[model samples]
Target: MSNIGNYIKLLRESKNYSQRKLSLISKVSNATINRVESGISMPDPDTLKKLAPALGASYEKFMAIAGYLTGENSANNHNYTTGGNLLLKEEMEAIDLISHIKDKNLRTWITDPSSIDYIVFAKKLSDMGIDPDFVYNEFVSRIMKKNRE
Candidate 1:
């Protein structure tokens, strides 16, 4: 099993939580949790966000374990990668952006690449002409500041 899967299983066992219980608390399906625990599938960013609080862990910690974010100032590092290719800058921004969204359905809809909402959102960001490097540095700075709080 993957390190993350083992970690989650251990945490669940320690908390005396059944898979069904975790599913209920995390709002992630029991079958998906089982698949994640068995290493048959890796949980995505949204799943990690849900499971982290339920597992009594930090979202950043889980993201690091899942190879989504670097342990050190991940927001600052656009070079963070997985599967040998540079991870998409847009995907990282999407994950961070979705985390703050209050509407669960909207978050899911925006994350779906095939959705019209996702297309429009992506278009908006593209039209902004934002500088990636500046954004990365600013995001990292904010995270560092938050950690100091």
Candidate 2:
């Protein structure tokens, strides 16, 4: 299955939202939603962003879905918990950090289960000056530490 389809499925299931319900919430046509979910059509960035919030997800999530659709699994999985509050600053910082990492391998590792401490990961990226290789190594190191703990 294409990444877009996988993501659409994941987000839809996670939120317990039907495609028609998501269509209504996103103001997108149900056919469009179905097309995206089925990998028949890829939505533009703007349309994807609009649908994300309705799925109770963020733009990053939509980007991940896009990446998945493109057969690229370079999506960050930062399990950020703000307790129903959106931390705009932190989110922006994270977006900046992710943008800096141009390597797909590094990005995939950073977003994988092995490197889930998003706050620490972001801080490390900031401190290390956004070097993808360094960030990848640090992510591995952090994962090892967590496993040992």
Candidate 3:
């Protein structure tokens, strides 16, 4: 099977979703999901867009994996997490605070310090007396709005 197909299958199983369940939630046909997972076909941008949220991943990440993006652009687009010495103390603290959130996409975005979402999230957390839960909810709201656009 193709690398992207394996990646999707791993993520789907991690979420405990069957192919039919993923299809139902993602609004992609079961045949499409089967084709993707079986490495019979590659998903296009629109298909990946539909599947991303349902699979708890970002469309850019899927795009990168599907070879839709290339070179430095792909590196810039994908939200690959940087850890260890790369994380600032505030970033570490923010990650810890957000650990309770169940949204995998949000968690992935927040973990990548280079992501604009993480920058905005870190700035919000720096505000005195600001509630972490409120920040998380706001980010969730923003993500929902973005997905609609």
Candidate 4:
């Protein structure tokens, strides 16, 4: 759904800030913050500027998440080989794929980074001559099949 909204919520929660507190610190209204969290709206660049520092995250990260700029434009973004959140792009795809897992119980582990071995996943995909994207689609397809059963 809304990566930006999910990212904002993740940032806010990591800081242990309540919506009311974030609103006060960022000068963003509580209602606006709530709406953004609910995925009902996206914040403007100005709002992002205020919120990023308040949340202790980089503005470029938020702007890139918001689609204001492509991730490639930001030096702080995850590099293919290394940097912060080494699995972010892959993990994000995994998160998107989990929505297809209709059995709510089975979906629980998808968001847990520790549950996956990204190195093995990548190596196996490569060894199989499979594209990472293909595995993502296949995982979702398998989940959909379960839903149909």
Candidate 5:
């Protein structure tokens, strides 16, 4: 089964919500819910957000599942640089971007000094149109420019 479908099913079951019940709570049509659950259609971001709360899943989890559903990782292996060898530029950028995430759990995961899942996390960021390297560079560039002023 597709990851989105699996996630929907898992959340639904976990929340004790049937397809119809979820549809009602999310204000999405039953057909839309069915389509998503059956892997027949990909829900748009707005619909996905509405459905997340209905299924008792956080928006971050929904976004992750959506990334998987849209084939965001299909062509890429989970590659990430790790260890204390990370450049100062990358570290500062990570800190800046992590600060912008309003979701506490996701922010914590992104900023934690240890136990970072760069592969999955980076994939998620890329799916959202954020290039990790680019973000790091931008953050560092801004800081450097500031210091030179």
Candidate 6:
């Protein structure tokens, strides 16, 4: 497995950034970057966010690499991969909410949910405070409509 520090170093080098330069750009402290690159420590979530764009990398992808989020092969199975039937952090939350659905038909239609991007789904559900049945019925309606066309 590749180390987070090594990846940081490589990314910094590719960007032609010295530790101080990277700190200046990323708003991360030089000491923190040094410790991270030297494999002595890792950055926190906030620090990783600043450093990622500065290094032209995705913050989410970086967090995943740092083990804050799930990796492709991780046992946590947090849907880091595309092909696997992994239930991600968000998916787990979605499952929790969906479990409250009293209607069996709606529940079964939404089964597996492996094809759903639970991250987005859960956020929308939470934000609107909408009932799961409404969401499920909407999805079912869409499918049925598409079938007719």
Best by TM-score: 4
RMSD of 5: 13.5
Model 3 CA lDDT for position 7: 58
Candidate 1 on 76-122: residue-level lDDT in tens?
Answer: 64332232223344544444444456665665465443442344444
TM-score, per-candidate, Cα-based: 0.49, 0.45, 0.53, 0.55, 0.45, 0.47
**How many angstroms is residue 20 displaced in model 3 relative to the true structure, after the best TM-score fit?**
0.6
lDDT of 6 by residue, 1-149 (tens): 12556556655765568999999999999999999877688778898889988987556656766777754544554433435434355544444455455665555454333324544565668678877667778999999999999
Off by over 4 Å in 4: 71-88, 94-149
List, residue by residue over 1-149, the lDDT tens digit for candidate 4: 47777667655665667999999999999998888877899889999999988987667656666777664555455332223443355545554455445653454343333444554476568878988777878989999999999
Which parts of model 2 have CA positions greater than 4 angstroms off? 68-149
Clashes of each: 0, 3, 0, 0, 0, 0
Give the C-alpha lDDT of model 6: 0.66
- Please report the TM-score between candidate 2 and the true structure: 0.45
Score candidate 2 by lDDT.
Answer: 0.60
Q: Which of candidates 3 and 5 reaches a greater lDDT?
A: 3
| Residue 86 displacement in candidate 5 (angstroms) | 18
Better of 1 and 3 by lDDT: 3
C-alpha RMSD of candidate 2? 11.4
What does the lDDT read for residue 40 in candidate 6?
80
Local accuracy of candidate 2 as per-residue lDDT tens digits, 44-125: 8888778877866567556654643233333223322333332333443444455446565665554442253555556667
Judge candidate 4 at residue 77 and give its lDDT: 52
Which window of 10 residues has the lowest lDDT sum in candidate 1? 78-87
Looking at candidate 2, the ten consecutive residues that score lowest on lDDT are 71-80
